[model samples]
Target: MPDVQIRPVTADDRSAWLPLWKAYLTFYKTELPDAVTDSTWKRFLDSNEPTNAALAWQNGKAVGLVHFIYHRSNWSINVSCYLQDLLVTPEQRGTGMGRKLIEHVYATAKKAGADKVHWLTHETNTTAIQLYERIAERPGFIQFRKPL
Candidate 1:
């Protein structure tokens, strides 16, 4: 484990958060327009939004990021937390940074009165699956999507 501090992102964190955000998208082989990125940043800073983000800092540098959203669930009365995005710098992977970021989300979600925290990752993300298995259960759900 590294001496890292994790906290909610603020208005001042855009510069530090953008690179990590881009790296995450690249890891997933996806890209979004600048407008979407700008809107996401704004959501993180907005108190009224259910979407939130955090950054992990070590030695005065941001090393990881996590984004989560709280939404109503049909099966539960309490909000369900979706751990949407999690990423650590390539050099920081396997140093417990990923787990720490997730644990941070777990704590945050729990504090926010969420019933459970869940997320999805590509089937080919074997490295992340290893870590995820250690921390969460696989519920045997397959996702299907259709573009409108």
Candidate 2:
């Protein structure tokens, strides 16, 4: 296979991005409202929004997707980056595409003056944890959330 090329998502990428987005959501066994997805996509295209998306392409097809956001953190002067979502097609999972997508986000965050980049994955996702452990540190933080 050819090397994967990573690029910031454009408005034209919606058709390519949606399938990956749904796959990611399915992996987590969760779903979001269509309106929310629409808003998120729009945010990625808006220059004023801190959220962004990128796609990993191979042979002229989008095979992976990542969404990251920059946010203020009280601990630092520079904004921190949250790697919110990462997804690669099932067939492409173990082919280094995930790591490449992460590195792409790291490069983007660095360019945007972000202090740190962080993300979370379910404990059950052992396969991903294996790869993530090699590329990034496990800060030993557990996440908790409550829906409003």
Candidate 3:
């Protein structure tokens, strides 16, 4: 209910962004090495990289974080944006912070000439699905993955 500002993550945001990143990984019951986290942070700072990160700020504190990547797609000539990670602090969940973060990515992708923005969530994330369904359409594509 407070004034929220969404902005691209910067080198200075590393400290504020890490906790949200960790919390996000924790929510998914996953863990990554510190080096991987460091590499991801660096990628966001690299202009040449397709990866990017943004944060939702309320009164100078980051309440949420979103990570998106752009890549070539066979379905369209324009690049497609993949929203890889979205995390809102437990206290901030359902407060529209997540929506704001997602919309920010959508706008960013559009400005970059991307044709579509897509993402996946755990099937059990019903609360998040409720919001996502209202904003976007599901194409009923079941993901099949094999981790090497």
Candidate 4:
């Protein structure tokens, strides 16, 4: 609890957000083309897009980031929020920054009339899973995907 402030990313935040974004990708051992990263940043700033992102700031530095999206669900009339990405700087982990970021999304989604918020993480991500389990339930769903 180091006087953290969570807020939606502003245009001026690209500098602060990029390092955290890169760290997040590094954590997952993934890489994306510069074009994809550029597009993702634009989406966050676009009011028309359902994709949204926010950063956790501490002492004027961004220590965490969360990206969420709202989309229609076949099982519910109201939209469902997918908490797509969440990452806290290694030094900030276990300081509750991650939870605060998620709570921010929860409030935002609730205000938007979303039916639920859900996400998936690799099974090996036990640290994140621990935090997630405390705040959300696992419905035991398995994900299947095929890249075209």
lDDT of 3 by residue, 5-111 (tens): 99999999999999999999999999999999999999999999999999999999999999999999998999999999999998999888888889999999999
Taken over the whole model, the C-alpha lDDT of each candidate is 0.96, 0.93, 0.95, 0.96
Instruction: Indicate the TM-score of model 4.
Output: 0.98
RMSD of each: 0.7, 0.9, 0.6, 0.6
Q: What 10-residue stretch in candidate 4 is worst by lDDT?
A: 1-10
Ranking by lDDT: 1, 4, 3, 2
Candidate 1 C-alpha lDDT tens digits along 1-148: 6589999998999999999999999998999999999999999998999999999999999999999999999999999999999999988999999999999999999999999999999999999999999999999999999989
Judged by whole-model lDDT over C-alpha atoms, candidate 3 comes out at: 0.95
Model 2: per-residue Cα lDDT at residue 32: 95
- Give the per-residue lDDT digits (tens) of candidate 4, residues 1-148: 7698999999999999999999989989999999999999999999999999999999999999999999999999999999999999999889899999999999999999999999999999999999999999999999999999
Can you list the residue pairs that collide in candidate 1? none
Clashes of each: 0, 0, 0, 0
